[model samples]
Target: MKKLVSMALALSLCLAMFAGCGGTPSSSSTVSSGPSSSSEDTSTSGFENKELNIAIFEGGYGPEYWEEIVDRFEETYGVTVNMQISPTIGDIIRPQIVAGNVPDFISMNDNDTTGLISSMIRENALLDITDVFEGPGLEDTSPLKEQVLEGVLNTAKCSPYSDGKVYLAPFNASPMGLVYNKTLFEENGWELPETWDEFFALGDKAKEKGIALFTYAGIHPGYMESLLWPAIASAAGIDTTTDISNYVEGSFSSPEVMEVLANIQKIAADGYLMEGTVALNHTQSQTDMMMNKALFIPNGNWMEGEMKDAPRADGFEFGMTTAPSLNAGDQRYVMTSVEQFSIPAGAKNPELAKEFLRFLYTEESVKLFAEKAGGIYALKNATEWSKDYVTEGVYSMNDVYNMGDSMVFGFAALPEGSKVTPRDEVFQSVADVMNGAMTPEQWAEKVEASFTEVSNMAK
Candidate 1:
């Protein structure tokens, strides 16, 4: 298996581009569509008669960004964009997809509960949009691939199959790890730990103050992947982590990985985790953490915007850090959550959908996204380009890249007719482990059994 390299170099360049920038811009001041002249000459020749049907999962980022971009795409191409966006978009579109009436483009994620993307991967039902990246970007003459963050497109998140063709396009690049209240840390003079030993030591200090060291969305154990995958890379190596993703035999039970698992088990066994954590849903866990019941929670940068209306401790502000390393001065890794976009294999207007996909990478569209969504796109230098529009917290989250490498986690796509999912094997049993109903060794053996089944299917 090939080792996935770090995106540190690309992020270093992004940092250099915004060297002296400071302060976040107000919404009103950051609402320009960018220079219209930059996009005036682009031709939409054959796409004039075509209409696009798009399905978007309206989550924390909201639908305003999508609506704005769709309008711009329609205006530029002289065509109609019929967009269906909802919080339950998957449930709404699942029937349509089964009836062979799939939308031209979709903006849901693989980890979504509907299992739509996972199903599509199993059935090989997604369109091959590789040319969209290989072709020129909407804003410039450079290939669109060059505009993406380094090491982002090659992952299973974009290319589900181990084969080299890309089906899903990268939407946003978000850093995921432990989220904490920055103000609390400052008030207590608590230092962020670099090594696991320091991490446990800090947990002891936090516990003295009646704060548990960690918690997570127990009902949605998948959130733990943000911490687990990166910790594995930091402790074992990227190669070993990649092997786990590829379902290689013994990868999960390897001595190094077992040690990482044991440490995670120690969190539960030693009472470092918050009490009743196993019963709380995502919102409940996050809300409690914000109220200062816990020192840190494994989560993504979106936690702030997602819980904006929820009551929190006074002066609470979001802060993110990479997973702790095994030894001092060892390399750390921050798992990046890259949402996806794709065109279905069955579509009325594949060409028009492809055009709309490319249109999203334009400077105007990128700026609108930042202004309306308060998030950065996956394109290179996007954080720098939209720095004025995003919040200070989000900007600071991007700085985590400087402390560690960027990692994207996705198991290779399962073969058709396979009965088990990687999530079912790996994460679903986390509650059992935390409850002491199953030991870490038992967890590893069970996961290896599932991996064996999947490996046989591939063979």
Candidate 2:
């Protein structure tokens, strides 16, 4: 990935964690030989030989409540799950793979690769799941695998293959949305805004009382798209995936795109964005919001979990919504992605890993993930949040669903190597505009320049 990144730009790739959420009880600290220690093995007998050795990343994305699913799988299969949990996922896997001691399974993919699974496939380091996902077992376990909203499969399948022969199953998904301080909005008698103008208008109102309108990390590439960038693309009607293609490099430099860019600049110029936003990490920005230092932030819907324990005297309530539209005509939809999980091709026990993944996708897992971790589940029985501003998000989507998924996926489905568009660079533009160094048109040109550089590199 030819990032516009240098030491100057930063991002929190794991949106599920830093954006305020808890995860699995990873076994990074506990040392074990193989399938002898993970939550997937509580029993000493029965399906003992069905033990699975899993190479999972510790912390961040794991669910603290995931042990129940692991225990269930062990009870049913009588297998011990040896979890090789590591804080640095790539570092942990690279050495083991080089030594040919590939674990039985890998938990998920990270952004620090040239799409590792595909590269591994070409390098012969991964297993081909063309047979597994196509196998009948998927239907028996997760019917939603078939009914999953379109983008879900893309995350599991990765690039170089989109015809389903999936190498991974989705364990959780974090669709980006507006995370607001429900208490803040209520105390001020503000309903969650339904349109972009309304959203900005609320910012003015909040500003009068010392609140920044919305927050986004202009520093990180992953969180950039994971939050505000797609909403910007949607505002411009650029179809993010299309703009991300090398075929049309000016996708984000059009007049429509600049207007969206201008709105961002306008917000900053009007003192709606928080001070020092450019220097803050995604975690810090959200923490600032949890502390009532900002009024709203563009964040994954899973953001609620991370702030559930905030010290708000009124127990801060958070809500989700698609980014308000550029105008009433653009569209009202949130940017979201598949956020799927996959097993590395180099795993030692692909079958056992598959079974374990199936167990994690159960209804029980869905509830724990949604209620405690604050994720919006793609499962059939997923709960609908009913209190405060969260309820507004659930009910508002029915009308907005008509706007369609493409509205939010423009940048999401972009091709590899296309670094320009709205990623973190958009935020840089936001900062520049606030500093009186660039106009929206100038910002758009700079974005065009970034895209041009990557496009030329591709050629």
Candidate 3:
């Protein structure tokens, strides 16, 4: 998948450099000044006889749930939903969008390395569906805005432009942390660590037993940032993390940020990471943990489904938890990874697309999505919707509230052609520190320099 993304990104970059890929958003791209409270039924929305096109990203999950929802929608509204499913949805459909052909709805993720959806945002090609939330939900008469889980709308990823208008609807809630073998911990009589001191002590014990404390897949910043950033937020405080996320100048130079970096450097210097881990791809690192070559690997909730059939040690059972905190009584933050859905500005049936989105929050539709995909959407009480259907490792997060609430990587709007400064890139420094290529002090200096460059770009 990374290779495919690389190839597609290369092609897109070539096109962008030579063919002027900037999109002139049609006049229809204007959003309503505010949300509408109209009490209109789905069938009476003048889209009953139209076609609503949907393009969904098929990543480690089937579209069976979407198919079921589409069937019900067609039976109710007399509309045909042309559903196009592909693992390479970003690579294929993004080009069509660039050519002025658009789907009414798209579920591609902007966080993917390909940056397909980000490119569209830069081109102003996505519709603003703020009115969808103001409308009624599928099963109740209450407004959809009132049905969403709290703090979800607070996610900066929902509004990339930072203008307070929602261009994307957050769909799936995938929390990330250090995934480990529950059976292994039980057998070793090791308790899950709640603080940095205890966590490092466990690392010492694991080292004596020929098991490394932690390892991560490759040197990708996105992968490691999920684990480290939340831990940093918990240790340094969310305000500092927020400043860094929002591109506040010199935020990374804060003492709190430095403290988190020093602790991570200690882990690297102590030889707690598995040998050759920096070179391993995501699946290979996961395989190492599965085979008991390492004690824990940082990853998202999707780990179980991603490695369901892989070879593992006897009695292996997956488990996950938020990053261990700086102190025993500190507030721990669980880093969430959410997938998003959106409508194109020039979609043929924008109203119908929004109707389908609102229908997703319905009780029956939410249940069906969980049962089929083992994924939970962001509707109210969505996490508790179906326990039996939630994925294995994901189920452990049901107890996340016992520690603290969940938060995702901070979102900041970056200008076009801006490169992600090396200082903000966490994984590379992790790999470098672990491999003895850079000292912690040197790493700090590099980060300070990088952020300064980013500050210049913003100006």
Candidate 4:
């Protein structure tokens, strides 16, 4: 239920939080590179041993897509899977878990509620899936294990401080990339930005040309929030993954972080950003920008496909960029995360949960999850995924695309905080500064407050 940070910037909060894992990949984007085709009959997945009630996520790849396959899992194991769709979903499904009402499998991991699993593990509510990745008693999961993308696997393993083990198996990968309006850039004699200064200077030019440069989902902030990590890392010269993921309160309020907000404010004040951005979600903002009335929109590559249908007359060519820093010498990160999945400890069948966890990593399952979800697969050696818009976007280091710095997770404005607080409180703290109701200092204070209130959850 927690919102995902951005990855190649794949995966979403079903439709709430969306994000993928870090860094702009090199010219040759990483994908299926480990194991090749499989000739195994993984048809049943050995789930026939239990009656599984799966609470599939809303807006996630539906059970319909894999129902037949799960049926095979059921048939081979002489079991039945009663798919229970989660009409109500988010980072934590504690109410259902507490009431003793739980599906066998529930797919939602954003590290926001990863605490739930950690807590569940304390009570033995879930199984330790270390075996899922480092196989011993498991079947030949090579194909499936190979299917999971690296970034996706990292996001899947984003949890820290667990006792030398894992509780989740990523089913797919989703990275974050900057989605740009290509034709507008070409029409205006603009090229995709390769550095941080280009990003802001172009805003000045685009403003003069009456173009609303970048509009993003401020109300629904996950991947959008994650974008700040690299932006700050690039600006602050911080790169250690440990600092990126779990840094303290004032860490994000530093000058580097302040500077990025200052630029965003400058862009907004200069009228380079779309109007009503504060009121808009990711889709709406993309709609306005792709309509070509607005020039550029900051979004995960997921928005790339949505804009593909925009009339070319409006000049909607798709391109991506990594968010920028103050200068070129700064250390950079792709600032990405994934929408991950895990089974609760209270799950009816921990062994069955372990089996389904294995099923999710299979080549067929990972590939199927990717094809339907449109992101990278989560694995040590993820499959090559350049064909799709989402996959292509994450590999922003390509010739056609480039980045300002390496990608990072985040320090400021995490998706988990947004899930705990009302989106309005989360966004208005930033909006208030842009609107001049709060200065950067006061805004920083308020931002910390909004975040600290949510941090209480981790405690």
What TM-score quantifies how close candidate 2 is to the native fold?
Answer: 0.72
Question: Candidate 1, after superposition: displacement of residue 228 in Å?
Answer: 0.2
What is candidate 4's TM-score against the reference? 0.73
lDDT of 3 by residue, 1-459 (tens): 001223345356334321111111112222222222332255666776688878777665455666666777776677788776555666667667778778889887535666777666666778987777766676676877677766655556677777877788878777778788889999999998888889889999898889999888865546776667788888888887777767676677677677777777777787877888888878789988998888878777667766766799999888877787887888888877778888988999888888888777766666666666667777766877655567555677445546666786645656666676442464567778878888767776776676666678878
In Å, residue 389's CA in model 4 sits off its true spot by 11
TM-score of 1: 0.92
Whole-model lDDT values for every prediction: 0.81, 0.53, 0.71, 0.52
Worst 10 residues of 4 by lDDT: 1-10
Q: List, residue by residue over 329-393, the lDDT tens digit for candidate 4.
A: 55555644455456665567766766666655555544444454444555543444324423443
In model 1, which residue pairs have backbone atoms overlapping below 3 Å?
none
Using lDDT, give the best candidate's number: 1
Window of ten residues with lowest summed lDDT in model 3: 17-26
- Between candidates 2 and 3, the one scoring higher on lDDT is 3
TM-score of each: 0.92, 0.72, 0.84, 0.73
Best by TM-score: 1
Candidate 1 wrong stretches, greater than 4 Å: 1-26, 33-35, 42-44
Indicate whether candidate 1 or candidate 4 has the larger lDDT: 1
Segments of candidate 4 deviating more than 4 angstroms:
1-49, 60-64, 68-72, 86-88, 91-95, 109-127, 136-157, 160-163, 239-241, 247-249, 305-315, 385-428, 447-459
Per-prediction count of colliding residue pairs? 0, 20, 0, 54
